[model samples]
Target: MNRVEEPLLSVSERRIATRLCVDAPLGAGQTVGLAPQQAHYLRTVLRLSTGADLALFNGRDGEWRARIDALGKGWASLAVIDQRRAQQPEPDVWLVFAPIKRARLDFLVEKACELGAARLLPVFTQNTDVSRVNCERLRANCREAAEQCERLSVPEVAEPTGLRDLLADWPADRHLLVAAESGHAPPVAEALARAREQAGGRAGVPASAAPWAVLVGPEGGFTEAELDALSKLPFVTAAGLGPRVLRADTAGIALLACWQAWLGDGDARPPFRG
Candidate 1:
């Protein structure tokens, strides 16, 4: 387990090659260290050198451009030069879904991150097909998606919780958008449009709506009793993704996309987009 202890960057100037989302605080003159895996990626994989520059963001201070002060086998440090973008408000939408297979779960988490979901929650329903959820994998997928999508913050991954318990302890003000298949639910856009109108188009952190969450059941779908229970919640609004049946991953992404377009940050443009 020997670690490299050499400097990765030379004194010469270079443009940023990539952006990394780290857990360290970002600031000017701050020397942030990279995790072992990240160091390995830059050293052995990317083969970046001592003079290279890269962007760093911690979902806190803001995005910074940093120079590679040093890098080794399992260690790397960057000297934060300046902030490229100030932290801005983002949508507070949460994606609460049942765990599907590994591949689909990976896709779901990635798409959820790209779609601006503030949180990633996995819930176990009575008809759920999977018992165990790999939260670490979901986190990895989320991290990569955030970096690639130019998002300032990575969605928080929550531990797996039972549907009943989750519902019982749910936040009072947060509205839950349940994706219904065979119910009297309105279309996803139609439902969110109504809620947006009711909220009077505030256009704040999450556009003009209150806190919201999109829930998609397992592939087998929710049991009749579970659906009935969710429908009864005062904060729950069952929304349909049309007549065709969608896979759990598809439904979650589709519903969240519609929600963002309607009530979330639909009007806000990406900071990086020119």
Candidate 2:
């Protein structure tokens, strides 16, 4: 009989093997206790037993190789053996989108974390269907996405705010990219390039060095008053996604991908090791 060979795991799959993010401090030879929920997730969901080796990361400290020292019904502990990778600096990008349905909102948050968004803001627009958003659920989605994507840090999820309030308190230095549904606006790439050029002229730093934030409107798109207000803002750049109008969630993902490809680390090499 011929011997069979096992297929090798992909880079992303191998990186996510028994990997978790804990909210405790990590150091060499440090013993960290897992929260009750985390313990349940490991023992019940993952079926991990004591003495199992797992990788851990806390946003601040880098990734570490740890072993499960103790496992109980509601308690677990891990011993850090060594650091695997150092924490890398994330892109200074924020995603602001109108709150839509529950399922799509969760999807948006997860994808935002995977795509290297530093912050997530929920903006309530005039046409927004959802009146309230559960910020905790979004944060949990971000954590799960970060762990699976091998990201060093999870994006910060902010509470939902009205569109008017968000713009009223907009920062002067940060550039805002508005996804325009109208065909009159320029393409997203052109707008980004123009914003970069203007930023470079004002500041000595390169275009990629400037902070960026993307705003995607609700399904119905921004109202006339909202568009007029955004147009008046000096930091806002209106850009069209394409010929056809996109759904709220799709538009958010497309805008983030385009910005990352042009200015963020989309073209950069992957830092994750198999």
Candidate 3:
């Protein structure tokens, strides 16, 4: 690294405050265009002008330094500079939950992204009260959260689907963790710890860090039949979050945090930008 021609990034230079997730391709000697909303944010909210420096990242390309070439009321163009950080591996954790209220749902999406969930899935369970989920809004929240959290990629927000349909076509390779409220089951940490040991021992299941999905039911819990059906699925594993009741959003967030702490990449430290 010391022998490279390009100057190495300093700790202060690595810590840029303004990070934007753009759809345009990023590379040296390329022009990246910002969307109307992003332009508005820079122009009005941040009061940034031409030649101001910021960081840009797309889910595909790695993070890059950019200098503003043009700035206006609703449009901005930037000249992409050298790369700051290369794309790195992230956990394949997905949050599948019943849609809650607007505010709570937004918060859930943000926390899930910061907590290293690779995807967001809103499912319609038997007891779900919400009929329709606004996916576009969720995407906006996810993108903002990813940018703020210094993540190289934004978590994918899947279209809302029925629980029945989801499980019917669920991939055999991925495992699903269902939060059980009523029945007796092993604690989440215990279950995950045991599974981790088994996986390390070369059991039938894949390694502990494999892709996983966590399912959180709606305010009104799943019906008896729903539980039975889910339990019968080979890929589904029920884990208890303790005796206390938890809101739909809370349960989802807690489960993901627990998984990351137990089986996911909890050992990885956040990148130092300062």
lDDT of each: 0.85, 0.83, 0.85
Best by TM-score: 3
Off by over 4 Å in 1: 1-17, 202-209
1-274 in candidate 1: lDDT tens per residue? 1112333243222234588999988888999999999889988988997867788888887788887889988999898887878887787889999999998999999999999999999999998979999899899899989988888899999999999999999998999999999979998878877887788854443452478899999999999999889989999999888878999999999988888887878777765432
CA shift of 201, model 1, Å: 3.6
Candidate 3: TM-score?
A: 0.92
The segments of candidate 2 whose C-alpha lies over 4 angstroms from its true place after superposition are 1-16, 196-208
Give the per-residue Cα lDDT of candidate 3 at 142: 92
Lowest summed lDDT across 10 adjacent residues in model 3 is found at 200-209
Off by over 4 Å in 3: 1-9, 201-209
Q: Which TM-score value belongs to model 2?
A: 0.89
Candidate 3, 150-172: lDDT as tens digits: 99999999999999999998988
